[model samples]
Target: MNTSEYGKVAAHTLKLRVEGMDCGACALKIESALKRLPGVSDINVNFGTEMLALNHDAGRTSRQVIEDKIRNLGYTPRPAAAEIAIPIDTGRQEDRPWWQTRKSRLVLITAALLAVAFGVAWVAPSLSFYAYVAAALVGLVPIARRALAGAMSGTPFSIETLMSVAAAGAITIGAAEEAAVVIFLFAVGELLENVAAGRARAGIKALIGLVPRVAQIEQDGEIRQVPVEQLRVGDVAVVRPGDRVPSDGEIIEGLSELDEAPVTGESVPLSKTVGALVYAGSINGNGTLRISITKTAADNTIARIIHLVENAQASKAPTARFIDNFAAYYTPASMAAAVLIIVVPPLIFGADWETWIYRGLATLLIACPCALVISTPAAIASGLAAGARRVLLVKGGAALETLGKITAVAFDKTGTLTVGKPEVTDVAAIEGDEDDMLAKAAAVEQGSSHPLGLAIIAAARSRGLAIPQTFGGASAVPGKAVVARLRDGFVSVGSPRHASELNLLPDTLSDQVQKLEGEGKTVVIVATKDLALGLLALRDEPRPDAAAGIRDLKALGLQTIMLTGDNRRTGQAIANVLGLDVRAELLPDAKLDAIAQLKAHGPVAMVGDGINDAPALAASSVGIAMGGGTDVALETADAALLSNRVGGVAELVVLARATLSNIRQNIVIALGLKAIFLMTTLLGISSLWMAILADTGATVLVTANALRLLRVRPTTAASPGESA
Candidate 1:
């Protein structure tokens, strides 16, 4: 549960799924109404997600009070639980017929009445005025009711209020037919906007629908279906071919190709054998497998992703916050200007009251800030969803906005640029054969879990060498060696430095160690108390896509550098391969200093495995954790790469910049259309219907433009002569 502290008082968070919010203005209206309550604070109403989250002092105000306030504001408030439930229909609501929904039904009814009024006018001209009046009144009733509700709930300048005023003013000036037409056009515009909004929300809805409602669990030696919520950690869940994995777990039985496109956005299906990890919401291919559940349904990967994206959408970007503040004052100011337009011309210039009043009504209709209010959040939500679809999880709009401004990227070496697992690369004989030396080393490190130890054991196994079966008394020396008794003598596997201290390293072997270390290989000595056996060389190689990922960042004109605790030779060797600069032998504090120095130039983004690089990640402008990293890393960083690809860093940048561009385009479209309509309304060149069209058309265009971000495919190419 999300909680907050209000001074010394603990405040409980309330998350509600708000329905009937037609535009961004409705979110603001609900927020305004809730803020007037006694103990509510930290109010956030996301129109894109239709979620209302707030903190309230439970001692002063209960959930019921907050919900009642939302109801009074003319919106239905339900607990957020309904939002996470898997819907029976995975398809989008917009796919259904437009007239099937309640909002669209109202629009259709208004249209039908308007057509009847027009038919009456053509057939009986004498009763045409009354017929038009009747049609206008029928539509005006609902709009006026909502307008009155908004005014009573603290939002006196809502879009509904403006529409109601415009419709009534037109009828007052004896233009009942035009009033009817304006009302009908407003309904049509709203219906179109609803469809567009539904389209924007379709991605999130699809994500919720990815997991099935029930999972097949094995109980008492019998397989039965159970609700996904009943799945517990360690329970065995059977997944057949073409079924979605019910929970995050490891495969304990069978092999199959799992399609993780819905969760991680990987295009290729991954082959999952025994002991392989699988996430919930992944579609299984032609195999039946039993998996040991590692995470509950509530804590599964899909649930976390959905939660993160919703919270991200709720967090406003810097631009969105600015626009919100601007709209707050802009609305009242526009209303005052409209009032002046209505009174000044008739009172001072002896102009016709009816004509001036008509112009004032048009101005009111044009003054709606719906398009401007939705501009930033709509693009941000789409950008987040798009990134999620690609497995680039940005935490919030601020982080997404900051990613675009990053001029330099700093990466931790181990587990980030490199594969993080060391492998035996070379073996040399100083006394006995190389195979004998490797087998002796493996005998000493048989039970060890160290990367270098595991590599030697694996190398010996791969070569089918026979390790001594009588080896015993194996013990580890911290940061140095693993010593064990083999056949009547003691054999040791340790670093070159440790061998030198024990006087067991031969001069030839010492020189060989230097050569291997210079090439970025870790040289370990395999020797006895009196004689040198041989040496084993191990190295953690760079990831396959490391070079290409670095090249992509350079192409985007950003500096790239590696910070590592490894020796200069090894760090530089990896850096040389990846085509990036290196800052070697840095302790944790030194890494922080390096990040600070990088930040002196511009905003620096730090990428790390998340556990050892927390300080640097926190110090940088935006920290991006590589996927499969520790939970601390994922939570500490502003964004995470669930795909675990180094190339995802470049893609994330491209997506952020694309989102910013989309936002700018939306703002221009929104304000530009409003400016044009505002001028035309004042000049008497635009009618009331056209003013409503301007508002509605701008909203639809902005929303549609924001949805284009969902289709963005980021590609990488390196330009010539770019460097860190």
Candidate 2:
């Protein structure tokens, strides 16, 4: 029975590494070849990462067929291998670096061909044609053969086909030297491009290689070497000093300083002890550790980070998408223009067909748009990869672009600009004993998730007040208060707003609420059925980095605003510390309106972390979530800081601007060279060989320029004028 008869072709998607793609045109060729297969549905080829993501019917066409099709298109496809990264200062060695791979061999062979062709032409002019042909055959044979194979398999419009046709045309016109130079130079450019592309793709691979493949696991009181994949949750692992943690887990014993640079970009090694969480790949220092694994190898923090960074590289910016769309039509139009140049000029004006036809072939060689197509993605990929290493995850090219333009950044006060942790600042009990009332309020706040509620519980516990184990439902909304059922009556503990909504607080008690609130503290009321027992005041302090970060943004001339649901005094206090424009007493929907209003002034970014911030985050020009561990924040924001560093925002802004500047430089170099060469070729002043070199040289130059972004690191000088 046929495979399809036995089983319906199961709809499936496959992600694989595609090797030997030279340019954006090569990516297009791979995509065009694979999509023609019987079962293939979608083909996405990313030249920046050299990855092909495809969706196809499994039974109708096997994976082998897809691989073979790609091979016929002059590329190689393989299943993605497991991730690996070599740790710094470790005794173990890593796999051979990218420069030592096939790319090096290609560069060497092409350089030899270039030397032979130029040497023979200068030394013996008579045999120069044959020598050039020999070099062309040697250098162009692989590309020419691939084009022939593609032609035999009914593939069309590939860069290989275009180059092969142009070379054959030149040889026919006694221009074999030009043809040989074109082939040799093209090879050189592509190899250099391969190095650049490989550098960008290596970021995640380098991250993966940081962790040890085999870890020391404690099983039944014995330490045994085991692969990390085999280690399950709850497995205790023994991590010695000068070793890396095997997975995300809590330390059950021992103490150490953990270097978390690989995971969160933290430069300082953090002190860790029992019950402290240690992430996979963090280097242990000075002391051994017995860690209880909380996540498997696949679900560890390192894996999650790698996955997000890879996804960020895959997503295209608006400019990249537009370039792709433009190139799709550009190639076909060039073919048409080539035909018109050859036939129209000779037939209508009685021009020499040989010279005009040669010009037409040269035009086709110039028209592939390889350099133009890659202009944005190359820069964007480099920027994204570098940002990932610095703890900033710009989700896509669009976000990176938007981030560069943000003139005003609206900050959510509670968890973004300030530390989310709150503490009890003051307490006033009007009717009952302050200690008894605080204890009852703390009991009602038991197991509560709110920062203010946790503060009350913590304050009571620290003062030796006994808290009951259980509590009833909240008296008002979820964030407002906590209510506990009692023998006499229910006791409710919530914000002053809850009391005002219920009309339970007396006017005299209201005065006390205002007085406490005036001191920049959040006031809460603890009440029985009729009378108020007391008022509790809590305050969340701004992060130490908050003032510095805001100062830096302001120094850069960015308009800053603090948006919060906290009352005027509380919000103003935090804003004043950061020296920001303040917007207070705004609920979730009101926050969305505030974001819209800010957008009207200029491009605006919203910095937030919470469920309520989601709507405003979506409404802003760019939504930057703090420490994207929260599901809602991760889903809503376009960018995330992996660590709880408010200063990451400033780093992201600088990086984004640098990326935009790099992108502009690449575009100028790519299009400017193309324009100059196009004019020269059309005017018959530049030979076909020169045109090809110009295209190749421009690609190399732009790529090298874009790589400059990789050097603009976080916590360093990213720009010339860093603001006074």
Candidate 3:
């Protein structure tokens, strides 16, 4: 989250939970005020998350000085909890009911005074003026105080300033009743805005609630309850049926079905066995599990996810930055227009002074920019929360916006397009029995770690063959073969080229090797110094969903290409089945070059799952790593798919497009309403209270619309060739 580094000087970052920021304008006010202080180099305030993060020189400034400055701006600040820990209590008053909040109490008091004024007006007409004045004063006091604080904090044209000026102007024009009504309506509007903002922040709270308070640790062969924070790596924990897993760990005892819906949004309960990895917050179904903790409480999967989402707000979208810049000048421009309307009509056009002043007050209320400033961040926060729920870990708004603009997708072939594990598909014998050839090959590959070697041994075991026990002196030849001493002669199990170099491959056996290689299978020759034994053909097939997932990407009008280090014939065979283009036999640097060329046409996204693929993943516009891949891939990629499904690529694109559309809708609603009310107020058809209603209604509507992104479901393209 640090924007830059200071040479030879240590800098510190301060994070605070800023309360009472009802709209984006309030966040801007805090940021503008803090920027004037010495040692404050960078500041980021997210209105949707109500989190203020800044970097400063620790030698020049302290946390108390910065917090005091925020208090002077008329907002409360509390120290934020650690980014990777579950947020239990952060000294926030958000848990209180609406009626107990400061704004709600003030609104209730103002409403009571207004009701008393109405009753007094019916009893004595002469005393009605004083009664209305009392009601207006009660509501105007808080508004005037906040307006003064904002003005001193470097924001003179805030919404509170406009509201105070309009209410005071109404009272000066002898419309005390209308002035009281306007003040009361504005208070109600502020209360409603507070409530709506809470709903938008509910997603973060839900994630924090997923972790349980207590964990059952197995110490000295007995189970005892302990706080989750006390859990550490290498500790063993017991998870009973119907209970949530306390932390991220690996199962070592019992098998169970785990419901991962709350954590990963996966609908079906996954069946897990011994040695399987389980995440925190997954529910154990119908069986107890003893798991060895792999990650501590702070480093668990759920904790990391929360940390990612909270930091995502620091990376703003281009559109949101544009709106922030535009709003800086917008408020002053509106204030100037109101002054012109009040002065020009009465001074030059011979209009009545009282009526023109009244219309000017209404225009001031109509020009408040609350709705316009909040349109972008709200939608972006909701979109990010939605993506997190589905386990599509997009880093920030910049990445999410860029994902919507991708024109093509490039996939790594080995583990991305096909199952990474190879299986023995066929075995042929030329000079000996097939069983004897497989047994010799398995003997040489007994403890080998290669995929093809393991597959050959597994085939021998499946057929119940008896491998020779006298084989010894086994060793591997890098990228060629495995050689071993079998009884009296030496035997080698390797690629056909290795066998040919030793003059052990015959023409008839060579033909079989070419035939199997042509069919997208790898052929390993089993031979001796005298003659060739046979060959074992192993293949890593495409995943069951690979074809359908590729079709979906194509349907969305994105070009799909496969990049792999496999042979040309093998890569092309898989590409043909999935209906995509292929670039085979690519090394790490070659993959990087291919990504650069693809970027020339448009933005490209690369999907890969190995350490060698790191260069190409970083070279592309957006790098997406599979969940089961190496840690290097996950760390280098901009985004990740936790479900390990190929179809998630299309889902990510669809979600990005949907979020962009939602943002556009919010902007239209915010601006269109203001345009309509501005025209009516100038024509003397709208009153002061009506203008306030329009502004308040627009802010509430825009926020509610943005929260709709939380309910968005995964969608596919409607038809083939549809533009994304």
Candidate 4:
């Protein structure tokens, strides 16, 4: 029967905060157990974050039942929507060293007992056997109980089972001292592993501390403190010099420099002016400002970032999935191999039963496969956490892996490659009175949501042109045109192609349009009924970092192309500035086709920021979204660059490659060490103590290797620990 079978109804997914997941195999075991339950469709367990993202039919399964199921498997589980409870013994332990942790203290007591037993064995030969027996009983009791618990839970092939069997086998052979030492070291290793996982998780949570609980908002003329969660949109916050901004808002008064390092990873401060955006965690410098909140505290950028990062941690990577699948089979194979070692050697070669059986016990302990199972997930979690700190967010490990290998990149012109804000440069009156044309056009665009329409209305207002107080709502379609009813006739403002199709274009204006388009200006034709009134040419400046960003990407060997709906001349003019290939006059579907065509060459990345481009982003091998853009783009893309600096593409690629390399290194180190230890144990060259120590050592080594990713920094960004 297929284990992947799901409920008939679509499953709702949620991330659950899980505890007592000791290893990658523990994650695999939990996944297997949950899948056997009714209504569960999928389960993604991230050992690094100790989280499980699962999907189940709500009617069949509930959160409380899911929690109960996890508890049944000898683990802890709760909805991730609530804060994870720390299992640390708080208060007294909080003031003491980490070594004083309850688990660590227990391990220390076990070690001290083992030490006294060994000392007595050397000093008093008569009491040596009794001391060793006491030590073995004390140490083996807890291990045996855990093994029994695992057996009762239907997980008989667990690490605890292997440890319990090995210790019992050693003691039965009169190796009581060796058995006691193995337990001491094994318990110590368990404590170290839990601590290591905690440290790995902390890297992702480091940003949580930056969010302020209270904000100072001025409700009349007097400033008062209010909880951030209580702050409402349109509420004004009065930020003094050297304070963190408490909400996603727009500066309505004053000016200052903002250190955006908390969000954008830019070390240098950015100047804040009236109308500029201020995020919840950004630090203000050297000025007082009044900011009108645009988003409440819960919906702010910082909060969204934290949410996405946690989602990323819960998301599994291809390598992790493969490793988990491999471990599932590897564990059983190892048990079979150990069984063969115990019986086959004594029967076939007439070897002594005691020696071969002892060898088999050591082999079982060495073949646990915990290190190999965790190799990829640990590195992937660290990668996701590090990317968040650098202000880049990858949707999952799969995207991170794909991002590193992107060979070709397609960019949307208006927003991605250039500042999407276009200023009105020329309004050529081809027919009718200029004032009437401007007035009618602005009045028609008064209720528009398009950038070009907004620009037209703003230009008209700046020139003191009369904008009608009441206007009909404008209707629009992507890549086509927008139209609204005017008092005189219908006013149309959109693509020149739309104007020509409507028979409102004049042949004489061809040369004028050609000249403006050649200068890289976006020309929008304004028409009414049967005649063209005027054409507005707007110039959207390329972003300051666009050229350098293009250069960086090119130098890194990614082919860059400008994919836009703009006509050929305008597209070419802009592409020429960035020295990129150009694809122009494309509709939304055409952009999707372009992505497919690009993917034929190799893995392609589509960078876009509009609803029209969502299909293209979803179709590409990897999609990169500008954080400031449409929600659809953000949702569709694989990764998000949260700042306008397109140079971040370089940073993202570098970080992805580094993370992949780190994962590879961890896998090699994990498997290579395991193989050598397993072989030694099978050949009777390794003892039970050596096998347990080697297995524990490999776990610590791989964990330490994966932790190196948290130190990964962008090449051109900032030095380690520097605010970038």
Candidate 5:
């Protein structure tokens, strides 16, 4: 399944960790350079936050290409940096230390001073305009310094420059009070936006902070602490309980569970027996272990997540790119419309110049399109936050949007549809009683280490069947079965076909065994020397939520398909039980191909939980990996199931549908309000106060409406009846 097929246009997205962003001016400079790049449609740079978002066409540019451009623009890119800093200590002040984050304090001070002047103007009506003019002249010092600095450097505009222009224009019109009010309010909003952006950056900061500060390594059986950055490849590190793993590596010794939720978003503690791979940033839960560093910090999982998010932000969706293109011309077009509304109406209809000029100004304010600019990102941020709570980490809005449109969901059967482990499914006795059959099988297979043997032993334990203490010298006969001298006689348990080769006579249960085998269930034959005693059927249990999940998908109008490495009969049987429409059987490669085939029907999503499924998951429109499964699966999937519930896939779809609906509604409301404001402004019926109210009010409305998703609850009721 090609993700690019979901939309008509595909562009390359690159994430670059930016350095040296200290203020809005620095952010603006980087934004300008990025926008100058050939295919970049939009660039949003927050200097108070060290991040750059870019969207370009893949065919025209690559990740490295963009990094080169950023380098040329005098900024450092993430991948090529020698050392990456993990954000430590979240909720700290932005742009600088707490004392240095004085933007808000300065703005408040300036506003208070201006308020005093405004009070004087109000007390003396005659001085109302002049007193505020004096205040504007006082405020112009900082604004002029900023504008002159930009002008001297060849850059013509800054936020301060814009503020000076608006202020100068206000003073010329004897609206000094209005000018002061505008500048003060603008400063306050800028300060607030800086604070909000700071808070958003904190999430990533906490994530980066996970990069271990130090490592404890063992050399010659002696342990020593070393800076994590100084650690190199092949270094043997000792990780104590409750400590974060210093680097990505494999466990060499010890066994205990580890909490990797911080990195993988899987809240459950994963068992870490010897030889299990441990990742950097995962907390060791009561386990002392040694690991050889396999990857550098740059290649670590946490670093990669940071890179993914940064790149995702830089990248633009097709819709977003289209909007940007529209805006380039749209803003100028709106300006012309406002001019025409003022000039042509007064010239042709003999309207008062004041009335028409006010009409033009109203049109200008109405045409700023703040509602359109702010709604989408705010909604996305809120939705992403809500998803993170459930442990569903959507890297960006595009993937979140794609998940909702999934019309067909294809699953990799082994670890996704069924539990990764096998267990005894059915037990039937012929001439021998059920108890005797199970006992004989367990006694003979007690020493075997095969998965089948372990399964049988587990089944016997579950049924309270005991193996003889001295089932003397049980031996596995390679190609045949397991045999041992039980108290009664030499008992054997193996495949029925293998049992036949051992000269065991078929009993009445043989027919039943054949019938069960035909249903794709594995039948293990239990026998004494002469005749077949009974049959034990074994199969992996379908996950408790698998069927319900499939049912939910079908209810949402999504076609469900199951792909497996099992045989046709086994696949068909499981698909039948789950009411799935499509079942493909074969190798992992076949599953990948099957996913590709399914995509021709519509946008396809592949779900899986094993390393083998990684490629297919990556190949799909959206890869949904079971979180509790393989690391490869989790890293490759677009979204992960935190609870590892198959039903969570359905729930995700429901969430996506809700989010999309909300976005559409938001767009409608914003656009509708903007249209009405435009008509009112053209008719000379709107005031600046009304324009501000409409613009800000529409923003608040859209924001609140988008946030409705925060209160979204998965329907307690299931999707209406639809077949999988």
Candidate 6:
């Protein structure tokens, strides 16, 4: 059945049949297809169901064209079950004159008139006056309409339209040629603003385009290519080399290296074997694997990212909200003021209309606030793109703004500051070499999925030590130890307390365990023949950059704190290295409360792994989750470190502050320049050319300055060995 069967508004629906998708990437590709279309306002796609839903503007773009785009992206096009018009505020271009329909067109016409006026002045100096007046009129059309409408709408006054009116008033009095120059310049400024805004949205569009389409499903014991959405939970799917994982699921069979860089910002490929959980959007390297779906297409990692970013863009920041309202009213007030400057002065002071009118035209040229309107949004967009490039995904301008003001940074101990997985840092043997002990440990723990056990096996493999055959009668005791047969004797391995409980405690092993524990490492004792032989100490070490990064935060005047589930000694060890002021331990809920306590001091930002730390991340003024940690953390945190590096926190803070500072500077320059010119025009001392210079010049300056962020590279490196 078609999407119309679902009773949605068909006019707003875009049905896209896509191709070349072998996983959840297809859903993302479809969503982007519809979203980028002219009239399509919103879109959602289900990879497992092979379906898409969209809300569109039926007038400006067609569902057919959108569907065609989906087909172009290599997907089969099918109508959705329903289509509906969403309440999106898209006003008609007809409200303003045709000339102002787009900034580019306005700029072109303004340029043409300026050229004509200059040519006239060059060829016949006498009629240059009329040529100038004509040029000013060309520029005035857009400014006059905008200002008048804003005034009638009773909106807050904007500086651009006001400047435009002032310049135009000056030209009308007796300097018509000069008035034209001012209007043309203002139009040029508006054009530049439009260009910068367009560039800002580019990176976001590129990100949305990363989702792939289609999946190769294994159904009825036969491998066949089918729509990703058609693969339900428990359905098995085959993932080939270089293919993106279709859904969040567990590997049922086979082994492969998965590149999770796109989704998690980690450049390393993770080894996935049977029973290992894999996330969607991660690239499957060489080797094929059969996976059993665990999460639906909509609930997958990439889908959550799309949903979060899209909604974030829709939400306006305080700065944008203020400007929007201010522009609405400011335009018309400026227009009215320009008119008064011309007529009121003549009537009240008994001066000639020609002279006063010229003054009014000058005022009009200085009134348009295009530069001011475009300044902050463009900067915000650039900043967001910069963050994205570094594998950091900041929700929107609001989040970035909050990031700049964060005074205290709270970190979750596990995953955020330390690797979530345990690793063997020290291995010792009482009566044998290290390799022999590790080989036995690996063989015994090979089948176990416990974090500590995995660490032992991984360490042995890294050292190229071959593990012995699987041990018989293997038994795992909860929170205690694992006992199994070894070549020499029965071997038991677990925490020191557990070894003592089993009467396998040894004197040398106890001394080593205490020594390691004093170094803040977790110790597991290995006992043989009812006697502990050695101690294996493992600790999730602090990220190499964590210490220096914390120091950087302090340099920026931000306080740093560390919170973890580790014991006080372990927590304090990490805290001391990083110079954190607060170190809390032993409970997840306590982390959340600690975040609250930090907030009492000032605005606090909680840096964490999105998974177990969601509560604390949610409680902070701003939440920054490490990329690759968890899907929930990515969604819950206001900002995500796609680089999955702790040092990004420091860079993010610095970048945010820079962006805010640049925007403020631009606003001051734009408004300050206009004010100076406005005063000159009222005294009949400002020429039309001067007004044009001020308006367009300010626009170029601000736009160029806003682009300064493009050069503001991330100060954090993706890897410890990489340069920042």
Per-residue accuracy of model 1 over 1-724 as CA lDDT, tens digit each: 3444654657887877776675777788888788888888999888777778888988899999888777776667766664333422323334466667657877888999999998999999998999999999998888888888788878898888999888888888988988898888878777877777777777777787888889999999999999998899999999999999998899999999999988766779989899999988999999999999998888788888777787888888999889999998998898999999999999999999999999998888889899999899889988998888777889999999999899999999999999899989899987868898889888898878787889999999999999885455598888888889988589888888888898888898888888888889888888887766888889998888899999999988999999999999999988887899999999989999999999999989999987778788889999999865235534769999877779989989988888998999999999999899989888889988888877888888898898898888775644221110
Clashing pairs in 2: 84-208, 84-209, 85-208, 85-209, 85-210, 86-209
The weakest ten consecutive residues by lDDT in model 2 span 85-94
Clashing pairs in 4: 265-724
What lDDT score is found at residue 221 in candidate 4? Answer: 84
1-724 in candidate 4: lDDT tens per residue? Answer: 1223563546677677676575776776677667776888767777666678877877788767778777766566755543311212224322245586655766987888888998998999888867877887887776677667556655677777888888888888777777887888888877777777777877555776666778899877889999788899899998889889887899999989999888876788989899998887899999999999998876777777776776787677888878877876887798899899999988999999899888888888887777887788788878888888878888988999888788988899988888879878888887877777777778777878777778888899899987754345777756877777866667877788888888877887666887888888878888877888888888887888888888878877889998999888889988988889999999988888888888998999888774456778889998888855224434668888877578878778877877888888987888788788888877778888888976787888888888788887775533222211
What TM-score against the true fold does each predicted structure earn?
Answer: 0.90, 0.81, 0.90, 0.79, 0.76, 0.73
The residue-by-residue lDDT of candidate 6 on 342-420, one tens digit each, is 7886798898888777666666667766556655665675666666655667887788888888888888877878877
Q: Which of candidates 3 and 4 reaches a greater TM-score?
A: 3
> Alpha-carbon error at 161 in model 6, in Å?
6.6
Q: After TM-score superposition, what is the CA distance of residue 369 in candidate 5 from its true location, in Å?
A: 3.6
lDDT of each: 0.85, 0.78, 0.83, 0.78, 0.67, 0.69
Clashes of 4: 1
Candidate 4: misplaced stretches above 4 Å?
1-16, 20-22, 33-45, 52-97, 100-102, 218-222, 273-275, 423-538, 629-634, 716-724
Model 1 lDDT vs. the true structure? 0.85
Q: Candidate 1: which stretches are off by over 4 Å?
A: 1-14, 55-68, 82-98, 254-257, 265-276, 346-350, 428-437, 462-470, 473-492, 497-512, 527-534, 717-724
Q: For model 1, which pairs clash?
A: none
Provide the lDDT at 581 for model 1: 98
TM-score of 5: 0.76
**Model 3 lDDT tens row, 274-351:** 999998888999899999999887878788777778777557788888988888888899889999999999899999
Report backbone clashes per prediction: 0, 6, 0, 1, 7, 89
Give the per-residue Cα lDDT of candidate 6 at 438: 80
The numbered model that scores best in lDDT is 1
Poorest 10 consecutive residues of model 1 by lDDT?
A: 715-724
